[model samples]
Target: MKLRTFPQGVFLPHHKEDTAHLAIVRVPPPSRVVLPLSQHTGAPLKPLVQKGDTVKRGQKIADVDAFVAAPLHAPVSGKVAGIEDWAHPTLGRFQAIVIENDGSSEEFRYDPLPEDIESLEPESLRLFVREGGFVGLGGAAFPTHVKLSPPPDKPIDAFILNGAECEPYLTCDHRVMLERAEDMLLGLRIMVRACGAQRAYIGIEDNKKDCITHLTPLVRDLPFPTEVIPLKTKYPQGSEKHLILAILSREVPPGGLPLDVGVVVNNVQTAAALGRMAKEGIPLVERVITLSGDCLKKRGNFEVPLGMLLEDLVALCDGFTTPPRKVVMGGPMTGITQATLAVPVIKGTSGFLFFAQNVGKPEHSCIRCGRCVLHCPMRLLPYLLGRLAEEHLFEEAETNRVLDCVECGSCAYVCPAGIALVHLIKLAKFEVMRRRKRGGK
Candidate 1:
């Protein structure tokens, strides 16, 4: 088979050596977990419990009436300490339910499902996913059910399972694929069945040689047409659009989605979570997180409960090798720099990265470098977009297709002058969307 890849992406030095070989260790549930009501991409969830209300593990503590919303479940059997504004991993600040663990692991009984899930209807499978509160564990945090059930007119013909941990220093997905191959496949099978697609492809980067070796034989006997694809290891190869382009040679139009192109893409962990949810009746309460970088003493992949504080993770990792100048959530290129350690990990927390002060190049003025334009996966002129954004010309940036930018940081990575092209483009995109939402030009 010819190994395929998308064009114009930069080669990333995957800083996954530390945790790639380490077995995933189960993180003991914290004494108290802070469950954010807005862990996902849609509308915030409403608190379902009041102060002094006792809750059990796997009990739905918060929910919303919105179709796009994904509910939150209790990670441990505990009492509702309070519902108050708390620091969130991505949202900065949001209301969260504080639960004090009482040492009892009592769980609410899960409703039994049909013995043979393959025989169930797609709508039935979708309902199960929605009730289980599944979301994209690959960092976007979009509700999984919404993605699973696309509009009827836009029929899905293919399903792509993303196993490319292309982001630097993140290996949680890699570890998940190796350890939970069966579970991942189980989820992938359901996802394939749910999306009304008969063919599914699982894409893993070439760097994860062991994963390819482990998964190749499993698909041989699959009931549906499932193919294991070995992708070129490159930055942003895991992005839905790029993955679609590489695997199927199809282009998802600008300002569109994988669904628009007759394809449904998902993370490897997301599939695993779905498999676990359907099989074990567990909702999205915890996830695997990769903690690795030059500034950490202990580094490995861990299965941590949602809403555990970053400070707790730091402590669990034995603190940093030196006082980290920066701590980021996710990968170094696309991850956001954390402002405070008080924030709790949410459903989308993929990895925690720490870096010493001396690590990267300092920013400088753009020196007419066209590298950003040349390497952009979307083929948008990032340098021009950055210039327009710097001038606060949001309309101009949008006209130049700034909204098409995937924000992969490839331009910034390759820029000889160290221009913060991605940052400026993000600012422009934010302003553009804000204006568009308000009916402004």
Candidate 2:
């Protein structure tokens, strides 16, 4: 089969060879874990527990009054030291509940799973998801229940499973598909049932041929229509808009969501988590994260707790051989740089990349070579956006559709001038949003 190609995407070094074939290991529990209240996309969850209170594993410690949010749960049996402001890797400083492990390993009681899930109503299933503290594991961290509960006017016709692990050096989804094929299928079925969608499609990048081979036969029998479409191995192909376009040939309009086009996309890992929660009555405490980069002696995927620190993960991966200049939470392209090793891995963390020392010099000036424009997937002029943002013409940048930019870093990757186009676009988007919030008088 011929591979389909997309416009304005770059092919950079993957650097996944170090841990591509390594089996995933389980990291031991840390003595202390910091649970942030603002891990998801909506308002910060209100703390439900107070200092000196004891919490067991799977207990709900924080919750919100809003519908577009998920409650926070205790990952381990511990005592609440206090609520304090901690360094959040992505959101800067935020209030977090610090829990000191008491070494009890006590498990909290959960409601018994019904005899048959299919017999339950869709609303019941959605309630279960919300109570389980489920969120978009693919990185967005949007509440899963809210995503399932689309407005009545906008009906969902298709449920797309994002198996396209196109992010460089991130193989957590790849391993999930290969190992938990049945779980992925079951999760898709749950989603299909909940959304009342007609069909489901799993899109995998052509690079993961082994994953495709493993998932093909898993969905052969019973139930709904499920097919695996091999997408062209390109940067940002795993993005929601790009994946929808690549698989279904449907273009999500600028500044529009997949839901706008009658589609709801979920990550393969998120689907698997959903399946486990619905079937086995489990909450999301542990998730698979890829730990790799140049400075480590060992590199591989590990199923670590939600609040595990980067320092502990490094130790589990056999410690750093050389000092790492930069430590990112996700893939290098979109991941946030960690200020210190004490940063905990939140729900959206997929990969921990460690770059070697003395990598390269600082970025240089833009020479107007037009490489960024040539490689932008959104077809927006990144150079123009960057220039306008630099000149502080926020409205001009918005008129040029700067807010629609996905910030996938493709423009930065292809810039011969070493211009930081993604950063500039981000700044412009922030300003536009801020002005709109102030009523834009």
The best candidate by lDDT is 1
Among all windows of 10 consecutive residues in model 2, the one with the lowest summed lDDT is 109-118
- C-alpha TM-scores of all predictions: 0.98, 0.96
In candidate 1, residue 143 scores what lDDT? 94
Per model, how many backbone clashes are there? 0, 0
lDDT per residue for candidate 1 within 43-62, as digits (tens), equals 99999899999998899989
Best by TM-score: 1
